[model samples]
Target: MDPRLLELLVCPVTRHPLSYDKAAQELVSPKARLAYPIRDGLPIMLESEARPLDAED
Candidate 1:
């Protein structure tokens, strides 16, 4: 993933900063409790596409 693009990207639902989880290939939105998937070098930012985060996550 491009660092420049990561800097500009935010959580679509919360409009909050996203933390990249390289191991999981996801962009985590702590505020929204969602993890947006990153596939084929592209981020799937749609809320419907996001996975709900567990309390332990």
Candidate 2:
């Protein structure tokens, strides 16, 4: 994903800033405890498409 795009992206749930996990290809919303998937370089920002964080996460 483009760095400029990432900087503009935010968590749909919490409306907070997200951190990019390059290795995981995910946009992590710490406040929302959700991980939005980035597939084919496109972010799936929908809350319905998000994966809940595990206890260890």
Instruction: For residues 1-57, write the lDDT of model 2, one tens digit per residue.
Output: 888998899898888999998999999998999999999989999999999999888
lDDT of 1: 0.95
Please provide TM-scores, in order, for all candidate models, with all chains considered together. Answer: 0.95, 0.93
* CA lDDT, every model vs. true structure: 0.95, 0.93
Model 2, poorest ten-residue lDDT window?
A: 6-15
For model 2 the local lDDT of residue 40 reads 95
Residue pairs in candidate 2 whose N, alpha carbon or C atoms collide under 3 angstroms:
none
Count residue pairs with overlapping backbones in model 2.
Answer: 0
Indicate which candidate wins on TM-score: 1
Pairs that clash in candidate 1 = none
All candidates: CA RMSD in angstroms? 0.6, 0.7
Candidate 2's error at 7, in angstroms? Answer: 1.0
Q: Which stretches of candidate 2 lie over 4 Å from their true place?
A: none
